[model samples]
Target: MKVYKGIGVSPGIAIGKVYVYSHKYVNARPEKISSVKAELKKFEAALKTSKRQIKKLSAKISRHLKKEDSKIIAIQMHFLEDEVFVEKVTRAINGGKSAVESVREVLQEYEEMLLKSEDEYFKDRSLDIKDVGYRIISNILGIKNELEFIDKDVILVANDLTPSDTALLDKSKVLGIVTDSGGLTSHTAILARALGIPAIIGLKDFSLNVREGDEVIIDSENATVILNPDDTTKAYYLGKKQEYEDRKKEILALKDIKAITRDGVSVTIDANIGAPEEVTKAIEYGAEGIGLFRTEFLYINRFELPSEEEQFEAYSYVVKAMKGKPVVIRTFDIGGDKDFPYLGLKKESNPYLGMRGLRFSLANIPMFITQLKAILRASAYGPVSILFPMVSDVKEVIKSKDILQQVKDELIQERRDFDKDVKIGIMIEVPSTALTVENFIGIADFFSIGTNDLTQYTLAVDRSNENVADYYIPLHPSVIKLIGMVQEVAKKNGKKLSLCGELAAFKEGIPVLLKQGIRVYSMSPASIPEVKKYIREITLEGKNIPDGFHQGEVDGGL
Candidate 1:
């Protein structure tokens, strides 16, 4: 057995064959061509060949993978047919460049354009285009470019992997992944995490330094990888692997079990989903409902905002897929850090405090109402709830509610069936909402604490800003005190309070939150089993009364 070490990103163990991705480009010099027309003819042929190859790959992807897995390939198919890209290559070839030279020149130009972009999403998207281009060129040259599987237990390494590459990976055979580039929020890292594969990224020069088929051991929890391990290290990893497998089996057994405490206190374990296909995964992971269905994805990677019919189709699918499960759809919270190219939102000087959340919704009332109407219509098919983001005060909540009422009234006047009684709630993130909790208690149906933003706002530190990220602690005394206060207010008014934040998913934070009288903990579906396990382990000895607050009157239920 040979091992090669690289970064370990996500935490999970797998044993799969090594499938290395390599691309081969054709080298053809047009300098020997007697006429520019000949060079142009060659370029046209290359373009045709590239298009055919992309179509073939796309067909293969659709045939072999799930519908969700083939989405990225479908997007790439559009790029392959882009007129500008084709025109650029043709122009370069007309200039008497070789086929390889023309393709490379056009790709370089596009890459440079994308590299100059200020938006990270667009910059990353450019990388996808480059990868597609390289793959097309490689296919044109008749290169047998595919991942190589040499071992039963293999660790896949790459300089950087695209979403398509990650999707194409044979998860059944691939054990772990290590890459030289990508951040925690990068698509490659997110995909690896979703697939439950141990992954490590952002290691400098890993591809250049690591050799193929070298023996490796990956410690995913700590993001460590050991190359060509010694006997002692090998033995240590074997023990660790056994522990992991045992724990995994234990978790798997609890998959169908309800998330009820030992004392019979039932907590709703809902999943936070982004895409329609994720609804199935949520159900498979034993999620009782969809707590937070982000709608921003509909606006991303597109040329315009999704039409009402389009939005209805997507929302309807998710609601129908959930069967009878409650699906809480959050209104579009775009602007600030999240931009829509079609919306023409300029870069903000201070995005976190700029036009975002409720502010953006209020400013674009028509857009907000359109989504509200669609969501309400979908609610008729299943249990659906509307969640508004960034509610700092009761006035904003009132305004949003007023708009929702208007949409419902209009729908009723038109004799359209709509869920007029759909539950309306606010995301209690800003400190103002926590400070003046009573004003919002009766007005809103429930409160979903977005701790990621609450902590950032309370600490006056940007969570995305690494410089002061340490100060943005969800468990800080101030933050804990505020959460305690909010929970107390919710209890006093007989309202439901749940947390749909990163903090709720943390093992340490869950115990503390539960002790503070938090009943519902919403998190990523993948985290359901572990959170449920922790809840089951809570004994009387482990329970502690929260400081600086009383439980007040417990009333109302989800």
Candidate 2:
């Protein structure tokens, strides 16, 4: 047996045949169409074919995955049917361009539009249009390409894989994945992690060096790849694989088990989800509830805000799918480093400090109320919680609660069925919130520390900026003190609190949080098992709690 090593992204072991997705475009000779009318006819036919292919793929996705996972496909179908896009394509083709050239020209224009966008979500979605366009052109040309899945078990290597490509992969036969392009936040990386397949992305020249059906062993923990291994290395990896499988089996047995520590301490293991389709995957990963449901996705990617009924339908579907699990829906937190062209939010000089989170919601009160009403209406179906983001003071908290009450009152006066008693909470992210925790103690139902922003705000470092990314550390003395203070205030007020930041999933941060008296930890479902294992191993009985009162304890908190 031979072993090849690559960077491990997701953590799991599989032995499968290699499946290579070649999305290479073949340059074709320019076609000769006599007139604009003929070119228009060809364009129309291509559009029809694209629509049919989109619908077929969408149906296949709906059958294989949840609606949320299939939402992008549905959106692609809408794009194909969009009047503006159709008109653009028609005009281009009628201007005496070949069918493929017209489609390519239209796609280039759309891609430029997306690139000019300030929103990362919309910017990343530019690839979707390109993918769909490529599919249309390939299908029209009668290309008979096949995925190169090797007959023997091997790791799948690619430049960058898409969700559709990953879906086509036989999970039973693939070992792991290695890619030369992709980031941690990309959909491809997210899906691979969710599927429990070890993946390593961002390796330059990985595709050039790795050949088809090459035996490989990936150590994801250290992000290392070995190529053409010897007998001893193969033996070592085989033993490690068996040990990993055994541990996974043990964790699977705890799927339905509560995440209670040996000392009778129970912590809620919830999932931080973006779209409604993620609800099913959350449940499958043993998430007890939806801790953080970012609702801004509903307002994004369109020319206008979603109607109240549209928001209600989407929120209601997610709540119903959860059955009775607590779903905490956060109001729109946009306009900070993130932007929407349709909202007319101009590019800011310093977006992180500008209008965002609760500030943005308060500015758009009607938009906020619309979302609040939808959450209230959905609460009737199951347990729902409302959370406000980027709050720094009691005034913002009170104002938001008042607006929520106004919506409830309006619904009540109109004799509408809405839940008035939905729990209200605040995301403890600002430095002032951390310093004046007492002011919000009794007013808020729960406090969820968004360490991502809190760390940035406290250390005066922008996490997204690579130059200062290292300075945006959660282990910084100031950041640790703020978290400890938040926990102390929550405990003093006899209120429940949880940490719903990326730090909550960090092994180092989890121990610190447990010592600082944080009992609830909310994270991505994929991180649950390893986090649980870390929590289970720590003995807190004799551990000294890091008190934020003195600078020494504050320093120790880090």
The best candidate in terms of lDDT:
2
Clash counts per candidate, in order, are 19, 13
Question: Estimated TM-score per prediction?
Answer: 0.87, 0.86
lDDT of each residue in 496-526, candidate 2, tens digit only: 7888777877655766777788888777665
**What Cα-based lDDT does every candidate model obtain?**
0.71, 0.72
- Candidate 1 lDDT tens digits, 1-558: 344443344775443333344343324332455676766666666667766765766675555434544555655667668898778877776777765676777777877876665555566667667766666555444444455333355778777786656766666667888777775545576667666678877675666666767666677655676666778878878887887778767775676677666667777788887767778767877888888888876776576677887788788899999998888999988865566666877677787788888889899988898888888888888988889888877788888888888998988988887677899888998998889988886688988988888888898987656567567777898888899999999998888888887787765576678768888877776677766766666643466422311111110000
TM-score of 2: 0.86
Off by over 4 Å in 2: 1-10, 14-21, 32-41, 148-154, 162-164, 172-174, 190-197, 213-215, 219-234, 300-303, 317-325, 465-469, 541-558
lDDT of 1 at 25: 38
Alpha-carbon error at 519 in model 1, in Å?
0.3
